[model samples]
Target: MRKIACSLLLAGTLVFGMANSDVEASTHTVKNGESLWNISKSSKVSITNLKKWNNLTSDSLYPNQILQTSAKKTNSASNGISAKKGTFKTKSNVNVRSAAGTTNKVVAKVKKGTTLTVSQQKKLGNDVWFHVKVNKTSGWILSSLLTSANKSTSKSSTASQNVVDQAMKLRFIPYLFGGTTKNGFDCSGFVQYAFKQSGKKISRTTLSQFAQSKKVTSPKPGDLVFFKNTYRKGISHVGIYIGNNKFVHAGGKQSQVTSLSNSYWKSKFDSFKRL
Candidate 1:
């Protein structure tokens, strides 16, 4: 009887341990403005482990995507100096290779100002390589050619105001159908240029810009003001709001400052948004 009781107790303990282990390997829902780097840091897991557990090929994350945070009974290691995960930008045009070495085949040539989502890194002697994803393509780039995205986004408020300031300075620039230069600009092109100048990267068209941004109820200076049904149905035009019901956009034959309260504009006004 005594032997049977001992066996039962051991079985119960093992079952309880297994249940606890299952509980340890939990899931997290991705949120807006979150990265695998930040999630790993918050979850006390290595970025490598996070990717492996979640089966993520790239560092990109979207709002509400569920991810596994850990594996049962596995210790979450620290992301050491050899590996990092974050957003980076190309300093200049650079080749993304198949592997960490110069001998690897070049998979893509990324242009300057292109944004990269880095998921992993490897240090080889004096050289370090980052595993980066640009759009849907994944490859490796030399660390020296990459700059941290934080350098631009660290002062987000200032950058936002700078976008408006830059737009305000272009009041009289001529408008062209698809112009993206200082000499001429279309509505979306003007917006893209102003944001780029202020160290923010936005999409090239009004539709893409609207899709990528988050809607806001109370807009501040530098928030995006959208309009619909100006030329076509759905979201058509975009501008940078500069408070007091005013916004700056490429309109008519030139870039101009206009009022959201204006009858034509007010009728077409859509919701304000932020990137």
Candidate 2:
């Protein structure tokens, strides 16, 4: 009887340990400006798995929400590979960096429509970087710059192009404080006027426009690009993105086109939005 009791106790302890191990999983605390897509990229987990694990029915996320990044498994079956392999095409001229972040060296520059084989993905900072092979070069590119080869540009592209065309017509116009006309314009005023000309009416001020627009991850032409702490603190400037890492904005002495890669703008870059 003593031997039987000892064996039963050992079996119970083993079962409890196994159950505890099965329940253990990893979690992430959501941050401001983060989305389910962002978390999926960073954690190397699929959005489907994240939703399933956390019992989320929608993609909506709020700051400081604790989410499970992995699921509990009772069996020895593998969760499968985290990285995806696929054929992708560049949406615009893009830089392939030596590493996963923009701070890394540029290994190559590929033009728009370049075909690439993405073998893996890594999340560095707030952006997802894809490890891609083009020609003989292998480097990292921002996922935002590449789209699935099977997918086509959406219908919104045509509407965005119209806005870009309208904005470009006013290029080289002189900049003026609080100006909103063809005579001269401020940054927000320029964007507002361009959208109005494109048949889309948007808010007139940088703050209000930013507040009213929807945040976007993959910004296209005519999307509103915002910057913080330019002449003043907190979302002080705005521009209309014209794609290829460039935007048309009212800045300096005149309205002009500028590159987002410009050190000053890059440092102050906030987020892209769509009206």
Candidate 3:
């Protein structure tokens, strides 16, 4: 009974995080005198709807914050180090919020991964974005500003929304070596656990799994790919492709998002396959 209760709790939390977390669009710059409520009225999208979409809970905006609309803005690019876990990507939005739980509404597109640190973590009605410390300057940012890269894991096949939805719930779980199920996962363990959620049971090792699945020309939403150097001499670690050129795998400590085009990854690149 205790084990069953724990399983239910974990499943419930994972579902909640995925449902409430909608990566907000990158648009409208926050002017010195502006508020989200006003923007909502102007845009014709209801405040309630906007909050629901962006995972917000208030009615304010900040200066110089770029807001994403339906409009197609040219992609912006920059570079930084890994401030926290996860590969903070090339065109993801970095959200900014205040300590008072008011909407500070500062948003920016991440050019590269920055070692830029975030301190405060506030939860108003259970929305969990971070309070980031801007790089090389004195300013604040909301955890909502960041977005996971939309890269594909493997092109063999596209996963249903349910599968992707299930996989995303484990975004922050720590990587555990030899972990192949729900208790925890290393890169390959994460792959098995996610596939299991979708009613599939995959192999436990990268080398073994790599030999299995059918190779695909391109990566799609839910596919498996392996990496070298991380585990064995040749094909070592594996990850689930999330689209674009990225996959979400449990790196050393946690399961954050990552890419295949980066230096280390590019060099260790292996074949991608659909299961």
lDDT of 1 by residue, 1-275 (tens): 99999999999999999887666547677899999889888888899988776545778777776677867422334322244789999999999875577886676899998999988787767888898888877778999999999778777768789999999988899999888999899999999999998888889999999999999999988899999999999999999999898999998899999988799999999889998
* 1-275 per-residue lDDT for model 2 (tens digits): 99999999999999998877545436777899999999999888899998766545467766766677766431114422136698899999999875567776676799999999987776666778887888877778989999887454454677799999999999999999999999999999999999999898888999999999999999989899999998899999999999999999999999999999999999999999987
Local distance difference test scores for all models: 0.85, 0.84, 0.61
What local lDDT score does residue 194 receive in model 1, on the 0 to 100 scale? 93
What TM-score number comes out for model 1?
A: 0.45
Q: What are the root-mean-square deviations of the candidates from the true structure over C-alphas?
A: 15.3, 19.1, 25.0
lDDT-superior candidate, 1 or 2: 1
Q: Give candidate 1 regions above 4 Å deviation.
A: 1-154
The full ranking of all candidates by lDDT, starting with the best, is 1, 2, 3
On lDDT, the leading prediction is 1
Residue range 1-275, candidate 3, lDDT tens digits: 99999999999998887654433433555688888777777777666765543334345455775554432232211111122433223234443333324465334434445545553344446455444544433234444555433333222234444456667888888677777666677777787778778777777777778888889986667777777775568788778777888877888688877878878888887778877
TM-score-sorted candidate list, best first? 2, 1, 3
